[model samples]
Every structure is written in structure tokens, then in C-alpha cells.
Target: MILKTIFLGLEAGGKSIVIMNGDDAERLGVLSLGRVAIRFNGEEKTAIVHKSSKLADPGTIGVCKRVWSDLGLSEGAEVVVEAASFPDSLYFIRNKLAGRKLGSDEMREIVEDTVAEKLSDVELSAFVTALHSFGLDLDEATYLSLAMIETGRTMKLDGGPIVDKHSIGGVPGDKTTLLVVPLVAAAGLLIPKSSSRAITSPAGTADRAEVLMPVTLDLDEMRGVVERTGGAVVWGGAVHLAPADDIFVKVEYPLSIDPLLLPSIMSKKRAVGADLLVVDIPTGRGAKVKTIGEADLLAKDFMEIGSRLGITVRCAVTYGEEPIGSAIGPALEAREALEALMNMGTAPDLVDKATAIAGMILEMAGRSDGKVLAEELLRSGRAVEKMREIIAAQGGDPDITPDDIVVGEERLTIESGRPGHVLWINNSSVAEVAKAAGCPKDRGAGILLHKKIGEVVGEGEPLFTIVAERTSNLRRAQERLEKARILAVGDRMEMLIHEVKERPVVKRSFNLDR
Candidate 1:
């Protein structure tokens, strides 16, 4: 159909969309949502079709601004329209939905279509849902990982033994990357770490790092920064690595990033040229991989995939029953990380966890007594200097001290309901409270713990502190936790009765924790 173009001046996601006249639709035997091929100014692309007599006059097509820009046409331009041919990957997606494994080439085609915007959100969601519903087999997962790596940009580091770590994030207040990277890098290793923002928790490695230094560096800039400082922490999204995984991530974990985590990790590490990788899988109640068996299987999968992709991998299962550090937000965690590196923070868990991971990296690099070397670096202040150098390289203030970190102005202190021994701290509840208080986005938003498991507190004594940019968020978080006992203050017998929720949501036994 020949029609006049009416630019619609809007974004229709990545798909090109055009509206057809009702009369023209009837003449062409088309429906309201048919596919069409739009052509103007020597350019043609497939577009989804909509019909409206009011929006466009007869014999005139309405185009979104994206289509107009693609055609290099202004309003009232002329174009030709025809039925569009659908891509073949949709059939493979349907096959997967029917419990069929996709071949490597088929998966590659689907991922390429995703990156090229040839697939709509609905179509892409179908792919993600299929993968989620019938989780990919190891072969399929490995192929999917390779396809993702092939389609996106990759980082090239000049040095051998590019060491990296993946904190399989589940526990709240687990911000040790800030300390471990500095610790490992101080010992003459190239550790270029790329992290993501928070998903289900208050903060992620990248989010917390952003509180101190810029995490969004382009590939070239990231390379330069690492070259200068021997290590750096940045966001993986900036480098265009495994971009198809990012799309699946958007569908599965809207504000999170855990769907198809196996591929996500392997592909990202492979893209960055990491030779040795340590995967931190925190296992316990209220955390992912709650059992040693599950963690072992996951670790084996990591090793298998790493072998398939030619990378050496290790998995560290750490305690995740409670928050790792004293703080649980961007700014607060950044400060706490620096304090831990400075050997001034009282968070023994944070210090122990950081040293443990750094020690693993040191051991991977053939160092003697990895834990001791890691501690020596942290205590000797060389890690602090390395951190300063990294901060400066990433466009942040090198001399910025922990005192300079600005946390939420509005705050509330949670006190113990009754005086007794602290039995446990629910990781999920604390993470939820902090997220409600406005995290990741609000740099100053977070939570601070005063008492942990096995500690004692008096009635009305401080248990934890909630900080937020707005008083409303702080109050909301407080209400959520008012009836929730994240920090139980009673004996094991009493603890069995008290739970994380107000009322009994589950018949949970304290046997595992005990």
C-alpha cells in the first residue's frame, strides 16, 4: 500500500511500528496487529502494524519516531508497506518451550536476533521463560554461553593470570570485593573485576564500589585503569560482554541478575580473559545454595564449564547466616570496606571473608600461606595504597577517607525487644529492610548492624540502624521489621518459637543453625 507517513514521535522499544488506515487494512486483508514491511527513502525494515482511522487519515501510515529516523523522513512523507516475514528463531523458541534442547547454532541465531532487536520483548520473554521453565542442559548452557560471548565486545588484558572473583550474591551486607580486589592486586596480580548492581539485596559489589569510585568504565578505559593500578572494579555491562545474558537477566530478575547464573558467570569471565577465577557461594538459611550438596554440585558445574571454556575455577562456600559487615548500603558499605582494609573496622566477619578470598587468589598464584600473605598486605597498609590508586584511576578522590562517605541523613535505630543472648540474624529480612529503605539508587541509603548472632543486648538496646535519604523510607523499613525478629534475643528453646516473620509463616526448626 502506498501511504503518507505521519511521524509518531515516540519509542516503541526496539521494534519498528507503524499504523495503517482501517480502509487500507481491510483492502489488504490485514488485522490490527499484523506484521508489515515499511519502506521509505531507500530503506526498508519489518514493523508491527496497528490500525486507527482517527490516528491516520486514509492512505496514510503513522510511524513512530524511530521508524521515521530509520527512514530519514519527516512528517507527511510517503512510503510503501507490505507484509513482514517473521524470523525462524521463534520456531526454535517454541521447540524449547516444548522441552526440546536447542542446538548451538540455533541458540546462536536466537541470541543474535535478540541483540539485533529482531525479536520483540514478548518474543524475548518467551525465550527467557522457556530457559527458566526447562532449565538448559549443560551442553545447551555452554553453547548459550559461547554464543553470548561471540556476540558482544570483549576485554583484552596484556598480562598473564588475570585473576577474578564472583561473589554469588545472596547474603545481605556482603561487600568484600572492595577489600579482596585491593588485597589481591597489592600482591602483584591483575584482577579486573566487573560487577553488577543489586538485585534482591541492598547493595552489590558494583553498587557499593560506585559509592567510592566510578564503576561504569568503557572497555578501553577499564583496560587503561587496570594497566595503571594492576586491578580495578567496574561494571560488566559497560564492556558489552555477553549482552544476550543481560537481556535474559532483564526478563528474569527485573532489578536482579540471577537467572541462568551459570552461563552469566562463565561467559563474563571468559570475555574478560580471566585465567584463574574464584567463585564465592555463600550457603545457609535465607541464602542461595542453602546446602553443602547444592554448593558442591554448583561448584562442580562451574569447574566443568570452566574446563569447557579453558579457564581454571575454584568455589568457596562461606557462612551466610547473617550479614557479613556492619553496614548494608552503598555509601555505608563503601566506608566499611575501606575501614576493613584500613584495619579499623570491628566487622570480624568482613575481615575474615575478605582475607579468605584474597588468600584463595594468592594460593592460586602460587604464594606461600595465602591467608597469612593476605593479612600481611591488609595490616601493612599496602592494600590501602592500592585502593587509593584504583580510586584515583577510576575518576574518584584518592584521598577520600571513610569519614567522607555520606550515609542517609534520616536514620532509625532498632533496639532489642528483650534482654537475652542473640541466637541468629535472618539474612533475607535484613536485606529486605535495607532495600525498602532505598538502596543502590540512593547512594546514602542502607542498614547498619550493632549486634549479631551470639552477641548479647539489653532490652531497648540498639540492634541495627536504618538510614535513608527520606524519612518515609526509613519509617517504612522500620514498620516492616517492627514485628520481624531478624536478630533473635533469646535461648535456643525460645528461639525455636520466635521466627523472622510476625506470625508463624513456616514451622522452622533451629536445628540446622544449632
Candidate 2:
């Protein structure tokens, strides 16, 4: 069918097409080649017929044709379009991409096609935005989750009750995963965890874990490691689990949209075949869940979704007003996590959070005796031993110690200005300092807090230390600390502005009809 249209602009790569007047484009479907009739302002204009290949290349057109064919659209169907209508067309495309009652094979196709970079960033963004806006129903989320799982490599363990934990993230310095996995595994639970690298922060779980041992593991190696040592900490990026989630994350991270966050979390857990899951939801200023109420709602949602997915989900709403551990960078966090697990050093907050989380996992696995069991496993060297076994199994040095983990060459110390109690610590500011120090990149670059909130410090006492590989980074981090009002030395903490702003009302007119 012939359609009238105007060519808008070119997309990054080909995939450009003339826009028609109506939504019949979906009905006409995508054409490898089509005719366009342009009409301006209700007046018939000249036809601007062009080949679809002119918009993109032959390869892109072929892919589009294949995708359209998969959608069961017919060729030569009349399509009404306009260049300005691309945005709306995106929505239609996304809905189709989400698919209704999709099978495992179809889901696999989506993931493979997506990873091949067949979809442009804009198209990917549209699909993600549509899922976020319309919300993925349980069935759809399950399908999508399963699809993502199968698209990438799958690690199979020859056992049940494989224990694992995950944090929904969006909080910097919540390095509980690094600590919890080792702690649980040390307790003799089969815990094979896959973590992500940093997206916005300077350090992610994978980054931090890499500080101690290698995190990049193939699927076979991962399964072998888990089988041999009963646990392994590795990077998820290396092995795809819920790959679509990764694509969506590229969009969600920048926009901070998490409408389907709970599903995403549970789906990953389900995909990994974690029978028991402990989800840490940090709630406070600068965290994903900003309030206790919101955190509770999310916790409930996660538990319910997990149940539906045949997994047990337990959530903890931890304090996130500040960094959980003294370390913030990948290497620094890894060093600290190892130290804590090995019982060689102590970061009370980190230790407490880890023990609490590990305890919960142990409880779910029916080995609960609170921190007693957790501390015993850690202090008796069982956890450390397990960690060593896992590390060695994963191709890392089992004898690696905290001292073995190197730090940046350049370092700077932050001193207390006044002799008073540390009232508050701003997590976001701390993350900024760590980022400036090059935590994830430098591995050794990060901030180590010597004092925490409620701790009394003398004037000129060392408050924190910034480590970096370069002098410039040290100075940059120091400069950031100079301007950062992260710590408050007073009796009371400053309150945040949490009130919502009111919008002005607009008058409306209506008539009653008989």
C-alpha cells in the first residue's frame, strides 16, 4: 500500500524511514522497500518514494525485515506514517518486543538479537522505557527473566538449596555482597554469586571482589568452582544472566527509573537458581529507597514476587545515610571485605551488617544460631578457609591475604576540624570522593573512614584517608573532600527536605448533557 510521509532525520545507523499520517504502520508492518506519498497541511503533495536501504544499509534493512517477519507482518501492506511519528512507533515496537505469552525459544531469540547489537540504543531505550512505563506483569516478567537467563551462559550446580544474596543497588559502599557471600559459603552453604561491575559508582561488587580474587568466570568454570568449593564470587557480566536486564540497566541507571525493580531483582535470583535469597535494600538519603515506608513496600513486593518465582526472598532495610564500610573503591572494598572475613581487621559496621545478612541466609538454610554461628565460622577460620578454597578453585591464589591486596601509591589523610562527635556522613559525597580517587579503576584508590557517625574525634585527628595511584587523583580527591560537607561535628544531624511541592491548579469547564 502506498503511504504519504516526510523523512525526519537519520538514526545513528540506517533504520530511517518516512513517516506516514496514521498508526497504520503497524498494520502495514515493516517493509524492506516501500512507497511514500507526502501530503502537507491537508493538501496532496508529490510522492517521495524511496528504498528503505537509503535510510539504513542493506544489512540493517535485512535485520528489520527479519524482525518484522518474526512479528508476522505481511509485505505490501498499506502503512500510514510520518517522520515525526517515530516516537509513537517506538512504543508499538517495544510492546511487540516485550511479547505476549512468549516461549523460551522466543525469549532466547530476543536476548541473542539484542546482544548482537541489532537494536540501536534508541530502540533499546524505547523497549526499556515501555517495560518500565507499562510495567511487566508477572507472567511477562517471568518470561523475560527466563529469556535473559537462557540467552547467556548458564552455570549448573548439582545440588539444591544453593544460597546467594543480592542488593538492589543504587547505594554506594554497600559492599555486603562481597562479605555476605564469603560468610555464607564459609558457613558451609553452597553460595555461588555473580555480581555486576560499577555503572555509576567507582566500585561494584564485581570490582570489589576482584580486589581479592579474579571475578571473571565462564559458565563451566563457575559451576566447577561452586562444585569444588561450595561457593564462588564472580562477575555476572562475564556470564550473561538476564542479559535483557543488562541492556535495560544501561538505560535505567542514567534515568533512575526502577518501576519493575523488584521483578528484576527476583528474576535474576530465580534465573541463577537460588532457592534462598537475602536481598539487602538500603534505605535512607541518597539510597534507592529513600524512606522506611518505601523500603518496606519494596521488601514486601520482593518477598511476594520471589514466592511466585519459587524462591524464598528475605529483605533487610539497612541504614544507607552513609557508606556501610570504611572502604568505597573496588580494591579498597575488596581489601576490607577480605580483612573482615579473615577476622584480621575490623570495621564494626561492615562486620555487623555482614554477620546479620549472613545469619539470615544461614537461618534460611536451617543453620541459624544468629551471629554465634556466623562469627564461629569466621573466627574458627572456616569461612576464610572456604574463601581460600573457592578462590583457588576460581583460579586465584588461595593464600592471598589483605596485605597481598595493593593500594594506590599516593595517599592523603582527611583530618577532623573540631573536637566533637561525628554526627552525620553523606553517602553520596563519600561516593564522589571515592570516584574521584579512582576506586574501581585504580583498585587501590578509595577512602578509608577512621571515624563514623557518633564517634568523638579530637581536633586534628585523622578522620579518613584517600588512597590513589596518582598524585593528581589524591589531590583531586582531597579537593573534593575540602568542599564536601559530608561529616557534621555537632550534637544533632541536619534534616533533609522531604516535603513534596504543590502544583498550581488549573480551572476546567464542563457541561451537563441531557
Candidate 3:
């Protein structure tokens, strides 16, 4: 317990070493050299671990084996120690840490402290991997959500019926946020929307919004924008709300593990002071939730969790077997979303879905006839006006047109091979192709869908077009699209079936004793 000196080196077997005093070693239950612990003197502290090399001075104490043993290690154990405390960062680890399973409370504390800059990245990664492996149950997820909320900034708006919409994201070119926010806002509702940048898509809502005006705004600026326009689209990362979720996403992205953090996802909206919420769960062969059952379960979880968190959650299970809109990149999708708002775009599916979703938000926000209100807003140009106000508030010219937004000069058209019905357009393929085309970064890079599924196409008609700032990216996009066969056409329409075949049961058993 007394003040002690610190020494660092390696042990005989090449394990890191730390040196401490005899009294400390005895108190720590170390009987032999080569142990691990910490020593503090005044304001300085150092780690003591087993060192492979010999000590230069006899005065330097060797770490005791009993202390190492007490510190917890199995046979053939090795330990590495560092002087710095774990910084508050999410850690990506390949193996599990040696410890008892974390309880809900402990996990919440870890996540909160980590986000608050109390834990190091390595420790955070360790904790993340632990959670990922053993998995967080509903209770744990709920606690984690609360912890995330406690650690970050929360917006407290005095307005009622503030609605927000979110998509689990997998399908590309789903720029519904652009239309939905304005439509709902124009219906005399509050929707201070915040979206993320592209993680795996050619463009994210935030990325697309950036095409027209700045999406990143500070807390005060965001609130002002929302108060002035009744709605504003901005990037969530610019705010510190649910900061841990952002860190978790960075780690979760490469792992491709859907933590399915329903509470965490909803908490951000709750944190933003949203009372009404619409969640879009895109389910299809190529989407994140591949099965209808999976999407349903996720939707239920989101709704249940949202209810518990004091938010009304309405889930929309939408079609994502293909891309949602005619545009599959940042600039293209931005252009398309703007045109759809102005009722100038031809992508009826995109407009329809956006209007439907926005209508739901409107209904929840007290619009008696949500669909009609939403349509009137769009057709009468109120939604477009709201969007213009939002754009102007976010530091952009309100009068900017879709054509005024310059795209990449490099473009390539995919012509129909033969006259037939367009059978399918794979969402994953479109996402990959657009990404290859340098979408979110290039702003001008993305794909424009000219022919949608079930549409009749002539041999000379264009199926889609790829645009990019670079010719190499255009070629890459073309190559990826060609490999995936995104635009499939045939004389006959392909029908998907769910059939069950039963086999006759054979009754036979062998006697093991015999």
C-alpha cells in the first residue's frame, strides 16, 4: 500500500514484466517473480508485468508469480500491460476477454463510460466483441439504450406530435426522407430529421441531402432550422445524441453483424424529442431483413421498444427486393428526390412510397386525411416550398433547381439487349454498382434507372445509366453491374413460390445392444 517505484521489461518466457515492492507483492499474493499489477507514486502510475529480460539493477523488484496468479490466468498464461488507461473508444477484437459475463447494468455502465471517454478503444472493442458474441437480450438492449441516452446531448422541444422516420437501410436509393420530411412538415407537423452518411450504400439520406444544402448542423443551428421551417434534414453525427451508437456502427459495419439494437436505434429518435415515429423495414431477397418473418419480428421489436421509451412507433414493411427509386447514387438520388418533391420525376414507386410514408407521419401528427394532405402539399408545391425553406435555412439557395445541381460528366447508358419485360432489378447489385461508381464521395456518381421491374423495354431503350466523376469509376460501375446481371429481362415473368413438399416417413430402428 506504500508508494513504490515502477520498472518495465519482459520476462524469461517473453511475457511483459512490471516491478513492484516486496510488501505490495506479498499483499497481492505474489510468491515468485514475473507477475502483473499497477504501482502508483504521487501522480504517476506504471504497469508491472512479467519480463523476459533480466533486470539491469538489483534494486529493481521483479513482479511476483502469485500476484499474476491472483490476477487470474490459466496454465501457460501470458500477459501484456500498457501504461495508458483505455481511452473511451469502441474496440474491435477478434477474441473474447477472460471474465464473467457482463450483466445488463455492467454492460450499460461500460457502454456509457466508453462513450463518455472513460474507456479506451481496445477495451471498448473487447466489450463490443463480448456483447456481440454472447449477445444482448431485450433487457440488456434496453439498458444500453438508456445508457447511451444519458451520456449524450438530448434535445427537449416543447412542441407536440414531433414525428421522425427511420429505415434500417439495405436497399439503395431509398430517398424517402427527402420527401417524407417536407410532406409531413408542410402538413403543419414538426420533423427535425437527422440522418447518417452512407455506410454501405452509394448514398445515405444525409449524403443526398448534402447535395442541395449542408446537412451537418450544430445543436443550436439545428433547433433554429427546425423552428423556422417546422422541419429540417441534417446529419445525426453532427450532434452528440447517442454517440455510442455511432461508435458501435463503425465496429459493426465490418463485422456485418446486425446487433439488431432496436432500443439503441429508437433512443436516438427519443433523444431528439420525437413523440411520433415511422420506421421503414425493407424486406426482400437482397435487403437487410431478407425474410418477411424477420422484418415482422424486427418491426415488432422496434414498436415495443419505442412504446416503452415513450414514443409512438409505426412500422412500415416495404418492398426492397429492388432499389426503391430510379436513382442509385448520392447526386442522382438527390436530383430524383428533388424532382419527386416537385412532381417532376417519373419514378412513381419512389414518389408513392415517400408519399405513403409521409402521409402516415402526417396522420400521426394530427392530419385528418394524411394521404390527401400529403398529396396536396406535393401537388400544390407546399412540400417543395417547405423544402426550399429548409434548404435556404441550411445555407443554400432556395431557388436551386435539380438541373442546376451539376453531376459528373462521365456517363454510360445500359441499353436493353432485347425487347422484353424487365423481370428484376437487384437492389444489392445496384448498391454495389453505385458504390463502385464513387457515389457519396463524388456527389455526381450514381445510377439512373430508366426501366423498372415489370416494365416493357425495347431493344434500343436505355435500362439505366451510370454517372461518375472519373472514367475508371464509371468502368468499375459498369463491370459490377454486368457481373451481377442487375437488369434481367425475359419473355415470361418469373414467379416466386413458397411450396412445401412432404416425404413419406420410413420407420426403422436398429438395436444398439445387438
Best by lDDT: 1
**Against the hidden reference, what TM-scores do the models get?**
0.90, 0.76, 0.78
lDDT tens readout by residue for model 1, 1-514? 8888887876875457788888887887777666777777678877767788898889888888767777798767778887666688888999999989899999999988777656766777778888878888889989988998999988888877899989777788888889999999999999988888776567878888998889999989999998999999998778778788776766665422244788888899999899999999988887777898999999999989998998899999999888887888889999999888888957889999999999998998899899999999999999999999999999999999989998889988878888887888887778778878898788899888998888878888998888999989988888888655577787553625534656655633211100
How far in Å is the alpha carbon of 24 misplaced in model 3?
A: 21
Note the Cα lDDT for every prediction shown: 0.83, 0.67, 0.72
Candidate 1, after superposition: displacement of residue 305 in Å? 0.6
Quick one: how many clashes does candidate 2 have?
Answer: 9
Once fitted onto the true fold, the runs of candidate 2 whose alpha carbons sit more than 4 angstroms away are 1-118, 134-140, 494-514
| Candidate 3 residue lDDT tens string, 401-507 | 98988888999998988999998777767777887888779999888888888899988899988889999998888788766667687788657533447874642
Of 1 and 3, the candidate ahead on TM-score is 1
Candidate 2: 10-residue stretch with minimal lDDT: 505-514
Q: Output the worst ten-in-a-row residue range by lDDT, candidate 1.
A: 505-514
For model 3, what is the alpha-carbon lDDT of residue 421?
91
